[model samples]
Target: MTKISTTQTQDMHSALTQAIRSEPSLIGGHEKSLKGDAGDGSTVVVSAEEIQLMGIAQPWDWKPDPVGQITMEKFQFCDLEPAKDSGKYFSPGGQSFSSGYRDFLALLSPDFQPQSILSAVKTTNQPPTSGASKSGWLNVLNNAGQLEQKPSYSTSESPEGWIAQVSTQNTEHKLTLEFESGDVSVATSSKEVSVPPDQVYKIQITATAWQRIQIFPGTWYNQAIITIAKARESQYLAGGMAQVAFGPGGLINSRVSEFVVAMMPSAVVTMDEQFASSQQIQASDIQQVKVGGFHFSKGSPESAAKLQPQSVFQSASAGSGKTTISASETHATHPYILAVIIQKFG
Candidate 1:
């Protein structure tokens, strides 16, 4: 029989103790150390190879493969059995796992992979309708080149304001008025005025008034003009004058004067009157004339000579007592004449 030394026996015991501590579950919690000595009076011992054969443990000191040299196999699920359809399974706490089988199948599909990060996205183009598909910054750039047809004349009113529309040969004009307290009246020419070829014109007149009488005249007046040009552009021309007196026999008056000329073939004019009088005693008069194209010069024609080119007048007045009165008046005129020459040969 061979005998082992005390030092060898101690070394073997230390190695066995370390392997047990590293993986206690492998040994199934069995006693690790020996208590009795061999018959030869030396400590009992066991070899490292013998311990491995008993399924106690295996050595883990082997070197790992070099980086990037390892190979991976394609993923597969052939070994996994299909999930059972046992109607439903409930836990002791009343939680249902009826759909657990379907969830497990979904986890194994390609849909479970993480999606790729996106950098940009585009919107889908859609056909335009009267009023639809408006969203985000899309609304700003979508309706760039569209025309809205407006009627020749239309009026729309709201609680806060009113709008009036008028159309001409090549343009449309709109007027909006807002008022707090007062009456509003609008009028337009009833007779149609013919426009020559390649020419356009627009005319608008607006008047407003407010008055309060307390034994004297307390009144306000305003007027404005709006003009639309041939190229769909608008121009405004307005001028007004107002006067008021504050005493018991005071007088208040307002006047507006306008004259326009266009170098065209024919002339057509119309006059419209609008007035509002308070109490009693009021009077107004207006006269206007429109003429076609003509030439004015002396000896050309009696009609042409009658068209006065320049005129001046003066007057003076004096009164005294209850019946004395004196007055003077003066008048002056100037005219231009044009002469033509012609020659004939026999």
Candidate 2:
């Protein structure tokens, strides 16, 4: 990853803001939720708007140019054998027969032993059960006692609280918790309140800035979470989810969530007399330079004067033996003035 300076970050933010303002479709839209398969073989549902914003198009849709590409050579599969019945291939004994199969097998031979085919078959015959039960063979042999058992737990109702509304003003952000009996409003900058007794409140951090505020039931923030900054109004959501506005008058807008309610665990630095030491400057060997008769010391003035001649242009001793010298009287002053002018122009 490339490191970016603070100025670059600010510039990027400004450019992004300008792009969003110029393109309304970038943020304002509603689409059907699409179902897709996750890498883990699990089902995932996401809004079509999100897919569009991610720059992913349909199979036939046009795509932008690629920034870069990675090329790899000498890629091969090991231990793969052609199937007798079909064109497919298989690796026998759960071992790869790839290009480096021998070296790989030798490295693992000491610690890993392949299971026997008969042992694997015997293990597959036994079914996993929760509670004690007679095995099929035992049952066939007229055994009566249970061989396996599974434990069960009782289910009871628990008190719960739901987030009703989340709003923000110029000063602070507020979160309203809805209970069965009444509602409780809490501000981001306010003192921490003990969660209502006997109630299991779900606290979810929906938005870190001004964007869609989701009121889901669950405890998301706790003592483990820390607050870094006060909440404020913004135009973008987490992960760059654009805020959309609707209605004829644009009165209907996306939900406004807190900018930053809490953060995660961080180390705290304690300051004391021992830790609050000041920096000591060591100027034992330093140099002094003269520019246009003006003495500029790199270190202590007293030390610089001891090593160099005192300036004659001292206003305090002008009438005394010391004479006041102007830049016009000194021929070396012209070169210094010219250097300054060149530096400024360059």
Candidate 3:
């Protein structure tokens, strides 16, 4: 038996790239869904239970974790052996052993033991945040109501708010602020600014241009929502098939199906508006297209199959072939499916 090594597997994948490029039919349109990249970051995991509650398939379904499988070589290519019952080949003893078709079938049969992954893993969902920053200029007002200098916030803090004198030069500016994943918000010196001391707030600053900014103590983790976005084809090697144990000592499996896709608008740093606004995609038009997810296989069709479209509202007739669930009287799955379906269909 020929055992497959990691390097050997990579070599096999390399060979597959060449082979697939040389012969497109082998992969059968598997490369179409890949779009952006997740890069070297932490895994974005979603429990199966979460999928059920949302009436959406697992994100992994769209972006499968194929990391380990794709990296393996033997899986890239299979072998066949000749059969003994068919009278196709003459033995050294001058006896015909088997028929050609029988020999072929015998060689093709395999006892498959799918390589098992022992840990929960996922692919990067959305691309790495670009232009997202933790520190930005927070401009407030001086006690005299004059604009002061913009002060940078501490990167270590979260759910933090600041009030400072706006730079005299930037007085007219409406406080252009930036934060990681668009998570943080700033309230200017305007009357609209309101904060409850009991509510969880990270760092806060009281504004006074000449008097120096006052840093107030507040709760940092009051209401925190951590989103983990995963790409379509990342690999997850766990100890069991559907049932697996997570770190340290507990049985965690796909049975825990209700997880939440927290739509924290504040956390949305930015959409790839550049990609969305290039005139390549029309705002009014919907498309069924495929974009790359994490740990994906090399082929497009296969990659696309892993993802389920969301954020689009097509007629139920349009949803026929797609794996969609509908409520008796209404299609309650909103906005997410529309975009998903458009991307997939287009």
Candidate 4:
């Protein structure tokens, strides 16, 4: 290594202090234009009198040297497989082996290759070399259980001390530790404290760990992943009927007659469509008549007449006078009262 003498180091430090003092915060003042081009009949000169009057610091006199080209080295991954064995494989420095198949030896033939990575299957009919046959149908917990499952970790060694937290949305017995000895610590919503130097552990969480999800359906997930998605969708849909309404023409509260008709459980959707188009009466006349279990407008008979078969209206008239009433006096005073009753109850 090269070293600088004491005298040179002292001189360098002194020069740096002087350079810092001479520099001004605002490096340059406003500039003015000179009208004529260089080859034109105009002359340029610096005012020596003004230069002497306001002695500002001179600009750096050094010219910029050209920078040499820099080429970055490309990265490569080795294709070699690792060793595989029974006990946990360790490096000379005690680091765990990165690959399982290459690191450990066969308790059973490490040579066996399963057909599908995701599917449920046992490649061999034989049992484990050491453990009893947990491989057969009755003994198998799940297809996933066949593979080596990673061990889970947990700890309560936090400074504040905590066992775990419970979630409200699911029925499963789940625990979320506030701190895992030397991994993570639970704090306020926006903050988290890391575990201290004593320990560092890893914990595996299950699908049930999510436990609760209150995300808005269909669109919220898309919006979160691609940040400007919602804003871009809004901008694209602006000024169209698909857009949410804003000012004057926006009819957020306005209800459609078809929706009101659809709310009736027995009302056929086809009939509701016909009714909305046919009943063109004033709002006050909507309840004036009754037919086929629907409260009809005054104009509804005319509307229904246009759609109803001629044979059906004639059949209705024959039944009106023959009711067990036996006489007009025993009947309702209003001729349309029976129709109103049918409409109201229906």
Candidate 5:
């Protein structure tokens, strides 16, 4: 093992002291550009409401609803298996796992799972294997352009005493940490304090989750955006769609009504992003796909007059996802499977 001289250790500590000073509050709102980190030139926007959780710190007494807190060790499954019979949560014409449904279950498959050199997940200030770079680098954007699920570790560490936080529009948990001290010192070394407040809480993502899940069942599970929809047609009868709540258009939401599906739930359902107020993973229920006025038809997208163009995917629909279909495609499967695209009503 290579040994670090006392001088090098002190230098590392001194650097951490200079790097981790408190950042100015982005109270009302803030917008960060990822033109550099994510190369694709996307942007993260924060409205005043969102900034309360993102830039600004929440009050000590803030307690969210539903008595939320779940542990992955005890957390049950998402019912990945197809509903064996025509019953609750199962649409009439849905297909079975054999008909293209195995693709999703493959997330947990060891033989096919992708291997990423992820840091050993820890809830405490256990130093990462290396400390040459900055420590508090949380909310990291994956180069693969997909929200990959990190291995969740169970812990009961409280969220109190957190001095700094890094929240994002992508991942479920907002990383929070109470530094060992305000300044790094030579005596203790930098390893302890350099790791920013981090926790491996339960994760949840938005529309992107349906795009491409990178969990390695055994292989490096990666599917480019172009071929994500390849298995759409074979999943019919397995893609749930019976008795889903409806709307005016063939789909209550026309912006999202097309593309292939063979087997799935009653509709192209959308799961809510996970928010763990506590250190434990909380239970979640099936969510409805929320839709909105922001239309990206034939390539036109919702715009900010003077803002930088931050949209990444060049599409309105037609990608991965078993039950989901684009507006045109949703109609083709209509009356067959209800395209209950939930509306994210403002």
Candidate 6:
């Protein structure tokens, strides 16, 4: 079984970056919900309750394995077989399989046992801080005491009262969010669509950038909404499913139902406007779409299938349909993630 060694992290990220640029179909019209990302330098520790809650709320839905089985707490990917599958990447060939978030910790460090993590784990949800904004988006202060609403798809959300919320951060309008369907023109789109986050996958990330984008603290864990602008000509970002996750423990964000605003605003993010404008994405616009949370496999789907969508967010896989070494597939289309700026941190 091939596992993702930390050494391969950079290599994998580089491969994905290049792959997406070369393959448009890989990204296309995927990435539905813009799951909030962790701001640069922001770190949120995953709690034990969150992990347990997922286990009880959403456990692994596979039946007798292709190799062995392990209860996965979060939605993780492996181009070959989604971590949920008793397939490849994990304890294969019927090797010793353990459950819980410990699986991830194990990957990070085999010596870090589940028992140790179980004891050390604690549910500590902190309140807003002096430097943070509860709004989940960037909260920049201006001379007007409020940010003027940019001409865009997102409605005018006053940053005045939100200044005291659990928060921080801000955005641009010429947004390009392509999903698996492969529509390359998100910059000019004008329609609004509601799509399941799982159904639409994203690959908007770079090796250096993804490293800095952490999961929002006590993050929504579920998917959130995204507003793209359509006013001007923006450079083509990334372009394929390779931006998603290939190996297990790859970067996976929240999962939920998102209300997409195809109203491209044609906005721009200059260094000056970085901390100046506050295009707040109201919480009302976001919700959990997947039936059993992110781990939702095909069972939740009407077809009663598994390893199809939902829980599976991958482009380069190994075992699901392909065999032997590894395989690559696409379910994305456009790129909008940043390299240095913490674009969305909810």
The count of backbone overlaps in candidate 4 is 10
Best by lDDT: 6
Q: List, residue by residue over 1-346, the lDDT tens digit for candidate 1.
A: 0111121111222322333234333223221222222244443111111121111111111122123111110000100111222111100112211122122222222322121111010111122354453221112111344432110111121111211111112332211111111111111132212222122111111111101101110011100000010011111111111001111111211100100111111111111111111111111111111111112111222233333212111111112211111111111121111100000000
Task: Give the TM-scores of the predictions, in the order they appear.
Answer: 0.10, 0.12, 0.15, 0.11, 0.14, 0.17
| Candidate 6 local lDDT, 194-293, one digit each (tens) | 3323322222211111111122222211111112100000211122211221123332211111111111011111111111112211222211112111
- Return the top candidate by TM-score: 6
- Clash totals for all models, in order? 0, 19, 88, 10, 50, 45
Tens digits of per-residue lDDT for model 2, 1-346? 1111121111212322332233343244333222222334443212112110101100111122112210110001111211111111111122211212112122221212222432342333344354434222111111254332211111111011111121223322221111121111111122322223222121111111111112111121111110000010011112211111111111111111111111010111111211112211112221222321123233332343232222222111223222111111111111110000000000
lDDT of 5: 0.18
| CA deviation > 4 Å runs, candidate 6 | 1-99, 102-119, 122-172, 176-214, 217-346
Worst lDDT run of 10 residues, candidate 6, spans: 228-237
Question: CA lDDT, every prediction?
Answer: 0.16, 0.18, 0.19, 0.18, 0.18, 0.20
The window of 10 residues in a row where model 5 has the poorest summed lDDT is 46-55
What's the lDDT for residue 238 in model 4? 34
lDDT for model 2, on a 0 to 1 scale?
0.18
* All models, RMSD in angstroms: 52.9, 32.4, 29.4, 39.6, 28.0, 24.5
Which one wins by TM-score: 2 or 6? Answer: 6
Residues forming the 10-long window of minimal summed lDDT in candidate 2 = 337-346
Give the per-residue lDDT digits (tens) of candidate 3, residues 253-286. 1111011111100101122323223323322232
